[model samples]
Target: MIEWFTIVQVSVAVAAGLLCVVLGLAGRKPSDLTMGAAALVEVLLIAQLVIAIASPAFGNEPTGSLLEFYIYLVSAVLLPVAGGFWALIERSRWSTVVLGAVCLAVAVMVYRMNVIWFVQGA
Candidate 1:
């Protein structure tokens, strides 16, 4: 839970979430731009996962239930892929809405993870 990384991750997640919601409200289906943005956010989540798990090697460990934190992190990582697949399958505005909601969920999960890391410090 590096400070700078967490800040960047939260900022990106929120931005991506807002973008997804906007795209959904605009009635756009899955498109290159939208999917790419989601993918970007997904990559960031995975990167955060890597850093979090490896932090202990660098003498940092989150002072929380590491397993539970991992569950949230993994879910955050999975959401974009799930939402993308669902959007592809449904191919409607509602599908985009689902993606938007997924992104928002990811944002919330990211925040929770931060709390878990900060409040329950290693």
Candidate 2:
């Protein structure tokens, strides 16, 4: 995975999480801006996946674990895409909650990506 893209994804997820918390506190639904950010995050994740497929490296280790990589990649892409659509359809505080959940999940996915790249299973 691309380290820079991973960093960007993590930053975006944190920002989205903060936005969700603020929106939830204010009793406001998710705005288009929020959804847009989520979309941006998805785009970055796709880029990361492409980079990984092209150059799979984790701290000098060969990232040939296709199954693990694909699992994380698919989920990382799917969660935000689904959440963005679901938020648009729901358009309530629940939407923000969904976004928040997506953000949280993305964060976890990034961590998993790192582990997959940098650490060997015992």
Provide the overall lDDT of each model, using Cα atoms, as 2-decimal numbers. 0.82, 0.77
Q: In model 2, which regions exceed 4 Å deviation?
A: 57-64
TM-score of 1: 0.91
Q: Write the per-residue lDDT of candidate 2 for residues 1-122, one digit (tens) a residue.
A: 66666777788887886787677567888887778778877887888777777773434443446578678888888999899888888889878877877887887888778777766463
lDDT by residue (10-93, candidate 1, tens digit) is 787777778877888898887777777778889989889889979889987777888888999998899999998998898887
For residue 106, give model 2's deviation from the true position in Å: 0.5
| TM-scores, one per candidate | 0.91, 0.85
What's the C-alpha lDDT at position 107 in model 1? 78
* Number of clashes found in candidate 1: 2
How high is the lDDT of residue 59 in model 1? 88
Candidate 2 to truth, TM: 0.85
